[model samples]
Target: MAGMAAKMILGNKLNSVKGELGNLAGGEGEGNDKDEEEAALIEEARQQQEEERKARHAKMEAEREVERQRIREKYGLKKKVAEEAGMPEPDDAGRITRKKKTPAEMQQALQQQEDEEEGFMDTVKGFVAPFAEKLGLDLFK
Candidate 1:
């Protein structure tokens, strides 16, 4: 309840561009330079958008470089060598990376692994059973 409301408020605050300009709400329907002003406003929005995009790109590049450095240090690697080692790309910090498998797929994979392990265990028991029987040494004994 409270948490969800807080998250909704936070998410809205993060995703909005309302604070970029003042009095956007003030000029609702009518405008001074209807066509020209709209065009200019659109251009301004585009320019602001571009600047934000470039800033975000620069920030991401810096963070990625930092992470790459961290990965290299953690793995005891040099930059050139780590670049060549072909590590997987990391997703953004907040995003989930794994694909969601369908229930059928999940069950199939789980059953397959279970079957393999069971088969191996059965084989081992089968091999030992004859020796155990000859020595009057059943598993229950």
Candidate 2:
């Protein structure tokens, strides 16, 4: 009698434990599904943004081409070499081209630039020296 009652109680407890464990596992599976759905949404948004950027870039390039064509037609200008067009070559980056010089010429240019820099530095040192001395600073040291 007492043994039978104890057996029934143990069986009920075992069944309850099993049910709780099953619920926990189901919860984890639902969480994984939600995570997958969120990841898909993020990837879709990124792809859409990339498509928009490409479209804008292509549109700008097309507009530039149209403007160039218009200018060429209006001026009746043909693409010609700079020398044949009687114009100096255009350096797009605005760098000036100079003829290569002999070693003596290079040394003279370097000396001139050094002299200019020295004069500027002397003026700055003159102004800063007094303040530095007032603060007990020794610039030469």
Candidate 3:
């Protein structure tokens, strides 16, 4: 009879542990549901942001169109047909009137700018060097 009582106590303890494990697994399912809900909310927020951006872009476009129309009206500029403009209808016919700088010229300009900046920096550094030295600060190092 004592042996039977021991077996019954062990069985009851095992069933209680199994029930706890099942509850833990069920809690994981609830966590997954919460994660899904959070993901959905994030997606919704992204959609709302996209809609707001589009609305802002449309508003800006409308405002720009209105401004352009007002400028045209103020200047008394009439829309001319392609033939009335007395130019080639296609934009490819436009010529580059101004000459572009060559690579060597561009490099020379950049070097000149760098030299000027270096000279200015040197002047500032020289003025600050004595103060820095007095403070025992080796700024150059």
- Candidate 1 lDDT, tens digit per residue, 2-121? 999999999888667565343476474465558678899999999999999999999999999999999999999865443246774444477677655658899999999999999998
lDDT on C-alpha atoms for all candidate structures:
0.81, 0.87, 0.87
Which digits, one per residue and each the tens of the lDDT, describe model 2 over residues 3-103? 99999999999999998998887777897899999999999999999999999999999999899888989999765464556786655475576655658
Clashes of each: 0, 0, 0
State in Å the error of residue 136, model 2. 60
How well is each residue in 1-141 modelled by candidate 3, as lDDT tens digits? 999999999999999999899888777679789999999999999999999999999999999989988888999976545645776443544666744565889999999999999999999999999999999999977
Better TM-score candidate (2, 3)? 3
Task: Indicate the TM-score of model 2.
Answer: 0.37
Clashing pairs in 2: none
RMSD to truth, every model: 18.5, 16.2, 16.1
Residue runs of model 1 more than 4 Å from their true location after superposition = 1-32, 81-141
Q: What is the model-wide C-alpha lDDT for candidate 2?
A: 0.87
Taking all chains together, the TM-score of candidate 3 against the true structure is 0.40
Each prediction's TM-score versus the true structure: 0.33, 0.37, 0.40
Model 3: residues >4 Å from true position, as ranges? 1-26, 78-91, 95-141
